[model samples]
Target chain A: MIIPALIGSLPRPVSLSKKLEQYYLGRLSEEKLEEAYREHTRRAFENLRRAGIRVITDGLYRWDDIFNPLIRFIDGVEVNGLFKFYENNFFYRSPVVKGELSLGENPIPEWLNVALEIKEEVYPGAVLKAVLPGPVTLAYHSINEAYESLDELAEAYAGVLAELMKELPVELVELQEPALAAELSRATREKSDSVSAETAKALIERLEKVKALWVVTYFGTPRGFPEGVILNFDLVEGTLPENYRGDLGVGIVNARETKMERRDRLVDKLKPLLRKHGKLYVTPNTLLDFLPESVAWRKLKLLGKLGGE
Target chain B: MELQILPTSIIGSYPKPRWLLRMYSLYELGRLPEEDFREAVKDASVAVLREHERAGVDIPWDGEMGRSEMTEYFTAKISGFKFYGPVRVWGNAYFNKAAAVSKLEYSEPLVLDEFRWIKANTTREIVKVPITGPYTIAEWSFNEYYSSKEELAFELARILNREFTLLEKEGATFIQIDEPAMLNHPDEVPIAVEAINRAVKGVNVKFGLHVCYSNYNLLADYFDEINVSQFALEFANRGFREMEFLKKLTHGELGFGAVDVHNPRIETPEEVAKAIRKVMKYIEPERLYVNPDCGLKLLDRSIAYQKLVNMVKGVEIIRKELAKEGKESIPFRRSA
Candidate 1:
């Protein structure tokens, strides 16, 4: 079976973006802002239905970045300064771990409930999936003032995320682990590699206790992922490991650039992989929010074509 | 051209008047005529230039009123670039990002017309021209066509070199290449330095490198290797923290940031003087230029004007102290 899905996040429409800004500046009421979020969430699902995506999300319209929802709702976490999201032009507020980490009153369950209601209304048969920052990526992207080492930080993150995942209504989830493939300096890379692997192993053990998950890596080389774990590789900047054997995510569509991908050429390239792997997922190389709304829409149309619908 | 000790200036952008912003929107939506929009831009530029002069700025340009952004404005003029749509840089702000579709070429003179207009309008003998640097353009744009980022940057450098030569030929004295995107990738510092050197190659004029909101430690090692006359850095936002980094920058003049442009509270001259005093221990007064941390485009016009006022008044305090030692002025060198 071939699945068509997005990595996570869709660019909010300019109108919703304006409303968000107004809400931030206290010019708009929270009730009015919630109306905008609901309206935009409905619009996002409608767009996904138009693109014929089966496995979809609620567009993560409220998330400024991958770390946003976690940093806001998790205990022992404080928002720190902005750090560049890898080498891309975008930035995210770094989470500073202050004390023992644990899941507090998370908004994901409510968010997922809203998404499930929208899915049933907009596209009844669609499978709604949740996405989160993997422990390894979260650990490295943060400032570790409290944890003795990054391994301990990531282990704590894994435990907190596992507890959060159990509360989510969705069965399938994606843990974005870009740090596994991130390009770092020689010294930092060496230090992070072992910690990243250990963190990934710990996360796999914890999440497996709840439900199956997909590990998505982008923007750099893909490695260190355990076998039998479903994986996604950003083929735009990375190559799939030849020795890996599992359900594969072929990320052929370029998300960072505005240029369109050739649909026929990509379909032909994935044919061989589809024959070898029983389950294959087609996705964008990175988050679609990197592109403009118009461009991202066109890319989704292309993704629909690749779904062979 | 001669400059007084601690010559005060801005890092290019000033807040656009609200009326001008409205007109700019109308022009974008095709509600206003192009000729009328051009006239409004001229009026705004003159308005900002006069504002800087009133604030006691010694060296003022047109405040970059003719352009909306640093990278987008330059890439829009250069050949072989295509804009898809706007992308978010941060909260509520978006820039029209472009992708390089082919080899970059110098189709027309970028920023030359702006420089010419400002040169004719400003009373100052020497006006500072800020152009977006090549490495910044390459780093910010989507590189679908280039084999590597370094190649694209070098191609951009070759194109910018032509623009610099044209500006120099047209009698622009000082040109500051703004590369706020440089330190984002510390490993790319070598490429950035090489690209900068190539961009200013054979252009015999004073050039300043302006970078803000970045870790200066990345460039501290290659400060002298970059072929520019001045290094305009941001300090006020960080509370002038890490003043020790100035010791590593052995060459080039320093555009000392004394007023925090990111903050709305108008800094008192005493506070600015104290900040300047801390850096004066490392750099001579004649080699240090005082300015706001970065562009004042984000602040309201009234607040921006007051900040510059305080910045100049702060420099005046230091100037009096230097005058006692007979070191109140220095000749502006064309190149390092």
Candidate 2:
């Protein structure tokens, strides 16, 4: 049955965040830090299950934030150059591709293992989702000194992602391409439509082994994409009746703001639209990490009430 | 013979003790008393001042000890500004944003207590007071009262003017208005400049404006009109990319940044010297005051302290060489 699912990255409590920062500064041990970070996944999954949601993500507690760990795992890409993350105060380290971009051996699977442990602990054999940046978002964010063109860079990213997906045990994976939104870059405005569509199609084809491939667009309304996998647009771009057919992840909650919403109100918003689609999953429009931890928890509970069986 | 080549100064705010942050949180949660909070803040300011003295900063400020943020902290002190809640900056990082619901007023000089503490604790004759510029305070905040952003900024400027005027009257030698948002809102530079001019009105102290992580080329035309004695800007963060922008400045000396504050890799004295050499190409050493690219709040205390030490060491390397060449630093100027 259709249910509530996470886009990725649950809100990290400020105390935990401070611990992580301290870990980076060598004030805390690796084992203790992992324990702290991994403990949150248990709570995240527990909250998910209580919300009557089966499909979930690890909440990426270990990820130094998205676009990191992923780009840092690659050999040729040096994590340099800080770009403002949307209008947010957070800065993402831009991947500077000096040479060939290939995935290096890392502990990403181990992170997945921690989440899988939580899955086994409570909701045994439930679908666990993994979120990664889409090829377009990666190539778009990168400063390429080696690649001949952006198209080539996107292709390289696709090949690496396919490899990662094959190795990981995630039942579903979401590609977050918020950069497809125009405000990020002017070049995105003029070129993203055609280039991103091609990139998304190419990536979807490459990741044939993954159980489900979802391309989630946030921040901007993408005009269109080539048909392949489930396309999840944010509240701004997502609607019912006309667009819903195969499947839809209805973003019933706004993730950017800290306003708590009622479950009944959300269910009402989705009730009419849910029937139109062959499958529908309710979700927040973007990462819940932007909101306060308490507010995020309340939103998750709201999902439990509305998206529940 | 010129003044200390690359006279070192902080871009305000040193690494605060973890206890102060904890106490502030406790105070917010109503677990700590006001007297204890104030005492802790004064102690933090004293600690930061001692660190600056040890690092040999020529113009050290009070370290903005009780400041939760540049905007919200000051806004909390000001009348008519109300905070809704914290807004996310990034991973687990947030700054509580305030909205000017009523006309902003300079209810009290909030920094007076901290300034008084700095005066009592430190032996230094001159102390830099870095306040949020009207444009930045307006730009950084959510405006619910003012008709336009320009109007909000102007009103904020009037408030800041009252504060700075008090600081000048109380014998402040150097006052730096931090406008990190200046280049971010280029469309309103003229308005921002006017607001800034209004902020420093009738203040006779050596004024400085701190703007970091920005393209300085954008401010060329507006430089002379900014009404400040110094422009403290970041260079090491951009790999010293915009060094040529300094030559376009018609007024104000340069508060050149040599250390990269955001990076944990403590830059060597040689690395600091190399960055200063690039700045020397655009402006004379006499007009240069070396500092870090930005505040070292994000960095660890050890890293921040060492970077400042290395920055001073780097300036000493060049200073020694200049002395060998029969050039000595002139007496430090209180104003341009």
Candidate 3:
């Protein structure tokens, strides 16, 4: 059976996004801002349910950006500098490593609880998917002052993520690794030779507890990878491997673009994989946050329809 | 194009004054008067000229302070174009990439009036005007009018060529066509190059083509093929890695960028000279022009001014070395 899933984030509504930005800037009251965030998350989950997407996300509404919450949870990482998040116009606060890594006891569990409560009330049968930056991605993007090697830093971060997965009730874990794609964007021509196969294999071994660990690659396809981890690939940029016979996760819809792909077209495109794999995950090529809120939801609906067909 | 030494100039654009940026937004919203906004623009341009003069630049612009983004600045001036919301290109870097819905026609002279203003104020006989290239304008925007991007870029080339001829009539000595997106689409380079040639075909002036934040190696193959007098490219950001590509060039002056605009740290005069010296090993000193990697718009005004000052001083260091070697003032010719 095909699973229609959101890789990460439904686009926050235009007005709500504005308010959240203001909230970050301290122009808006905290009470009022939290209300806005709650409102947006509710709408995001409902939007997912309407699209018939059984695997819903918490919309990552509380996240200021991808690297923030996780880095905030970790002891050594500090958001003091800015680094380009691939070739995209959005920037993430560069996570600088100051000391030995530790996941400080915090309220991250409570952050997902609100969304999980909303999910149970609205779409009872829907499986909640939690998204995180892959350990290799986190380590590569971070300024590792304490860690001696990239693989070492990756193991430390992956260890933390593996622990968090146990505490959360997330049925599916999607690791958004756009950088894993050989050529992330037009501006980025270099191959991602940073994440070694050994480190990826080690991280996958650590994440064995994650019910279904889907390593999602966007921008372009990973030329090579560790074998055991389920690879969620962008169908546009990703080619079906000839040798690999495993559960495949294919992203048939493009989240960055405004153009729509019809369900029939997507169904035809996914037919070969559907016949080959026992379990299939249908997703957008990248995170849907880049698109206008209306267009993103429509694409999700198309994905859901494709999952059923 | 006989230069005794390495001449100094800016690629295009300077940092906009905070007040000017505010007025630009306010005026667009009808909160501020057009007269008030235009006054700020004029004042800002004057300030830019003064900064260049203070830095002792041989060739300078009106600071490209009159416009905001390179391509969209033209979009605002052209007819039959509808602007869209901000499209993110990199982290926190968004440009309102517009599209041409109908046939693009000039409602008025594109930068003629602004050029006239800068000319009236400056004593320099030679000044350069940089207009966004057709290929970049087409590439940056969503195309609705033309069947393909190449067709749309050609149409833009025809439109900009009209302005080119007009600039020549107005006695503009140097003109630069900016195609920062040129390397982004390599397969379309020939079409883009063709469109560029059409834009300045008959107009006689020292024409340059500028590309930034891209791999210069991708462009080395067709350097001589490009129908332009100069190739103004950014190298400071890449730590001057591809300077070896200069040895392959058969013709045209190289606008060598010595200051890093992407980073706020100022490169010292000695450091900048070292970069220029690396290029001199491949090309003659007379063929090299000093400039920053790209526009200083993303940087602070203080950083921009200091960077220009240091860059101008760097050229001075190389000028002395060139004079000692008796290679200065060699007439510009095809490199053997």
Candidate 4:
């Protein structure tokens, strides 16, 4: 009865002014932000632990952005200016991969160092989890300058991330495939003949190289989930379509709301499903602008109960 | 024949009242003086229903005026979520992004106390209560709960469905499930549609699904699977292309967003009229209704008022044009 709990990044709430100041001042010097971020990350983990969350993550507090640092690991890829995704958020743009792509001096060691520090200081005894944006999503969202095909870029990204995963120290790795569900159509639209099977195969192959992989998909459907990708993973994490097979991670709680009582029923409904999957994970819907600490703790308690921790 | 007005369907957008702004500011500032904020929000909820009634809006939304962020309000009420901090908006629309927050639980069910309050205050023909759809809730948030995003969305949908059922029992005639994120991630349409349908399953009320501009090129095909009666879409600000798609999709009444609520530019009655006339060519006048593209929160009170006024005038102009041509008058419908 081991239910999976959020051992991944929970959003960090920093005011706009602070975020800007930090971003502009080049204050991302590990020593400065790391100390404060580690403290914040410790508090988040402690809260989850107290709420009975069995697994934990550093909340990705140390990373300036999810894509940039990793892009630095790939050789021949010039980091371009950051693009503002929609509003206040931003991500680094990578130059196109024209030729043979390979990993530069592995930046995984630096990432792993941060993960290890968070594990040591934050959620000391809890199962550590690491989150990386899925390769397909990264390739899709990134600007492809010199590449003739997205498949080529995706393949390159897969190799880079897989290599990074091999070097990182963590019990479980959650590769967020959010873009897969929603962006698949775009991928198909852009490269109709080469999108689906190619993207799915590339993802599945890359995921196989990792030890404990949870291929997480969100926002839209990845035409290949239950049929294409999920079967290949160690644990298929996400709210599965009613028709999906294997394990279940019932995401019944909403991250935007301030309440918790509504999630209780979600836990109850997921119990039978969890039994079928051998384990279940209760998660909040998504990270939004406001979530009261009390509600988060309650969700962790439920996950703890389900996991028999 | 009095237009055979039997209320064939329902649609509307979440109305963000002025008081909700104050509450959000307070909550964002981390000084919500507890009792005061709650009382004000409750009052704001009542005001939302009243405003819709005054505007003759078909489906009355509680305006989502009571909550700071649509979904965060509930998570805060529940015990699992932790208040991480303000949400960061990406670019110029930075102010529009509800401050960032985080959650940690998925064990408690949402209580419909606010819904019950809205239900108690209104005696209107049919109140259309709005809830943030599960997919939008999941996409908008920083997820830490489940291993994947879909799982999180589905779980939220289940919870929302429970609330929706309860609201229906409490006298809601329609539910406008808002999911703007659907535009950002079109691939999740099937998953979102399923979650939404599941939430409103067995509930007898008319379900009005509202999705904003996320490249609605495939809207015709997408609408074929969703079981909802009316698709109250944001067409005006996004453009007239979506209307053509809706016309081809189905003959069902479309709640066409006629007002540009996002931009501060107040559309004049003439401009609104011209826009309506243009869209009416594609959509039968009888099956169209005027509304703002999305919520009015982003606009100032005067701007929203002008936008709505121009919208009503636009509809009036279209009505006159149809009458002159011996066509049937279009009944009023809500928009997102």
Candidate 5:
């Protein structure tokens, strides 16, 4: 019996005050944020190690915004003002892509560099994983007020992200393509939804350039997957809804409400699903919010036991 | 019809009922107690609705008393889809890829059933019946049945239309359709607006649209699309940046969120009065209704009550101010 492994990227919360101060002070001397990020990355690895998770990530500990942190590394992107997502109280700022996209000498964010360093330092033998926003998801989430078309912008982003992927030295890279699954309301989809297909194709092509890719879809159904755009990805991950029969990374534990029985049932549900798929990987519903240490441990134990048995 | 004003607002109901937390399994056969659950519905309705009336609210909702969960409640009632589980918020939207617990087959409209239950139990004339609109329901859930979200939304609208018609026939005077999803998918505004219009077609009742925590920049243009008599939005809690756009976009009545519902701290009457004053610049005092920023379901009972008291006091002060200035004042009254 091949049991699924538990793996996830845990991002550390950065205080808004500290992030602003760092941004305004022009303090790029020794990568101060990157140094602070290393400590958090160490703590995350230690936590995952204690929980017995075999496949670990730096938990994206160094970055302030998940997607925008890469702007510093990318050559043509200009940082803009901040915007708040009122529902969740998360903040994001836009980055303007300038003319003639050229790959930065370094593709990984300074935070990810610290994460990679921490992984080498802390868990020399364990697998190191890195995550980046999918080029398509990033393009969609970004404010395109300056860009003429999302398709044009997405193509540029794809090239940059693909080049960046080659530079990062990690076993696996998860490209979380959340926007691909977004259902454009009928009104807008009728006019602009066609761009999504091209965006999806461009993104998949970009990820194909990167090795050991996991194309993760979340937030919507996989109903309208673009036709004839097979990129031979190593893995696809998402919390399958209850009625879906497609391949899924079954999420049993409610990230909001932690219940042991719920977690067990989630594992039970995954057993059959995993049997069908050769190797399974389990991830919680989301990573932004903290899952209690106990729940994380239980999931890790379940995955480890499956692997061992 | 005489308007009755009540004093009490929100009471705490935490550790949500056990059935609500069970995902779509709550509606599974033999999983939940049918009669006992229905009784609990009645009890919840009486408890919250009566409490609001006693507390002097102009209109009272059962506090979403009949629903299991906010977004997932539609899965059990809508056809061609299944409940995946709770949706997790991602970049700008919510994502749920969980498999369906079971295929959805709606024999009757659940919202109608719940509305009837509430109407049968309550004596208040203007019991606010809250429904999750098509755009919100589709946006919040995992889309499985239709190839496109628009199709799924229209289907939801048809079901809601049935429920709205039923409620109208059953003497429901006020219906509030909640559409928080509009904030995330601004492109869905027109689709949502059209769906709502279709749902409430031929219904001779006061229709209110509730959108919370959205950037008013996108919502400024919403009035042109939606056919609602009133737009009840979060303004006081969100601040006054939206009022300018609201003044330009809205031609109908507005419900100014005067109290913060998510925050635990209670506002003073003076603070509430100040917030209302800011809103009055854009909206006429007669066209403005004072309420909490969002639903009080998340707040503790004491804080909710205190907020309501302050909100009502603020409205009274505003009314007095308008009267002294020779401006027409609309008295706050509850449904008779």
Candidate 6:
């Protein structure tokens, strides 16, 4: 069965975006802001339900990027300079690891719990997936003064994430590792072994607490993946992995562009792969956060149409 | 063109007044007509130019009042682009993101009208026209047309070449191509430099490249390759840290950012002067130009004005110190 799913974040509606801005500016009260967030959360779920996206995200409306709000919850990390999230215009604060890593007050479970409650009310029986920044990507983008190597830092992050994932009451979690493709590709081209497949696999292994896990990589040519991992390949900047035995995510939707995909063309491309892969979910190659809200919504609707076909 | 040593300027864009923003909202809602909206923009541009003059800025543009976001504005004018709406660049802030849908073509001059308006309005001998650079425009936009990203950038560069040549023909002396996205991909720096060179091909104007909030060290290797007279970089935002790279700068003048525009806190003349003093250890004052870290559009208008006042005051402090060494002023070097 084919299912439509968002890879990372769905663009926040303009009204909610304004409210968030006001809340950050200290113009809006937390109570009122929370009310707005709850209302927006329901709207997002309703939109997804109406569009027939079964495997849904919470829209990650509160997140600036994958690193943010989560980084704020982690000990020994300070938010630093804004770095571009891959080649896209969207930027996230680079996390500076100044001390040993540990979980502080994790708000992911709380945020996800609220989303799940809303999902139950708004779209009963819909699968709500929790999205987190994968350890390898986080370690690569972060400034690491505290750790000996990026692998060590990634492992440290996996320990923190393992603890956090245990708290999340969700069946599946999508760990976004764009660096797995973009950075690693560059590293390989330059003959620098900055991050290794073993390191990434080790990090994923530690997160066995989650009921199910999917590693989504995007933005460049993805190298080797450890066996038995449910992998999502971004077909836009990347190709499907060779001879992989797992449930595959067919990321046929172009999340980076504003152009609407022709459903017929996408189906033709996916037909051969669809027959081969046992379990497949149709998704965007990258986060829709790069596209305009209207464009992203249209893409999601297109994904729904593809899934239905 | 001749100019004073340590000449003060803004890195383009002054904060739009609240009234102008309201006018913009009304204009977008169709409450105000296009003619009225154009007039309002003209009024705002003139007002900001006067403000820059009063703030003692040596070289200023029309505050970029006519343009909304840099790349979006250009995309709207050029062919083969479509806007989907605004995308968030950071917390609560967004810019209208566009996608290259087909082969990019130059239908009209992009910044010439604004350049003509600012040139007529400002009393300054040179107005720094800040066009969003080709590398940045291609990098920021979603490319659906080009076979490769390099092709898209070069296509943009060809179109921009026409725009820049037009501006130069219109008696514009200086053009600061804003390429904040240039250094994002270090591997693509060669293409970026090539794109910039292609964009400025045969334009023959004093060119400045304003790159903000980036590791300026990356460009140090390719500084001579890029055909620009000045490298306007943001330093104040990072507390003027990591400027040891300045020692490697072999060619062109440096547009030193003395005031931090992202922060709301007002900087003192002494503080700005101290930052200038710290930077002057690597480069001489004659080759240095003082400006804010980036566009002042993010700051409140009053705060933006005051920051410029302090920036000019800071430059004045450095000017006095340079005068003590008989290096008071120098001719503005017109070639890269």
lDDT per residue as tens, model 2, A1-309: 357777777766666788887987789999998888777777777777877766678887766567887888898988875555554434567788898878899788778877888789977745787888887778777777788778788888888888787777776788877655532442111122234565656565566455468767776676555255676767744443375354567677777554466666776767666655646777788877666566677777776566543
DockQ, every prediction? 0.33, 0.17, 0.21, 0.07, 0.05, 0.42
Off by over 4 Å in 4: A1-14, A17-309, B1-33, B46-58, B77-83, B92-111, B119-124, B142-148, B183-186, B242-244, B325-336
Top candidate by TM-score: 6
Error of 4 at A133 (Å): 19
Residue B199, candidate 1: alpha-carbon lDDT: 97
Ranking by DockQ: 6, 1, 3, 2, 4, 5
lDDT: worst 10-residue window of model 5 chain A: A227-236
True contacts kept of each: 0.36, 0.14, 0.10, 0.10, 0.00, 0.53
Q: What is the DockQ of the complex in model 4? A: 0.07
Residue-pair clashes per candidate, as listed? 0, 3, 8, 81, 27, 0
lDDT-wise, the better of 1 and 4 is: 1
| Candidate 2 local Cα displacement, residue B89, angstroms | 4.2
Worst 10 residues of 6 chain A by lDDT: A184-193
* Highest lDDT scorer: 6
- Fraction of true interface contacts that also occur in model 6: 0.53
lDDT by residue (B1-336, candidate 3, tens digit) is 564467777878888888888898898899998888889999999888888878888777877888878877898788878764555443334466676789888777889988898888876656778889998888777666778888888888988999989998998878888987776655677888888889888888788888876656667778877788788888787667656667776677888878888788999999998988888788776677778877888788999999999998888888888778786664433231
By TM-score, how accurate is candidate 3?
Answer: 0.78
Residue B246, model 2, lDDT? 73
My TM-score estimates for the predictions, one after another, are: 0.89, 0.82, 0.78, 0.52, 0.56, 0.92
Judge candidate 1 at residue B107 and give its lDDT: 93
**Model 3 segments beyond 4 Å from truth?**
A1-4, A8-171, A178-211, A219-230, A237-248, A261-281, A287-309, B1-4, B78-80, B100-108, B144-147, B185-188, B326-336
* Candidate 6 C-alpha error for residue B76, in Å: 1.6
Candidate 3 TM-score on chain B:
0.95
Give the CA lDDT, 0 to 100, for residue A1 in model 6.
60
Worst 10 residues of 4 chain B by lDDT: B1-10
For candidate 5, write residues B1-336 as lDDT tens digits.
533221122221222333443522554556667776666666766776666666567666667666655665666655555433333232222232222233334557767766777677666655677777877776655443466667767777777888878878878777778876666655556777787878777777777788776666676676766777777777654444446677664466677787776567888888878887787778766566666777775555666666777777776776667767776434433221
Candidate 1 off by > 4 Å: A74-78, A98-106, A183-196, A208-211, A226-229, B102-104, B144-148, B184-188, B215-217, B236-247, B257-286, B313-327
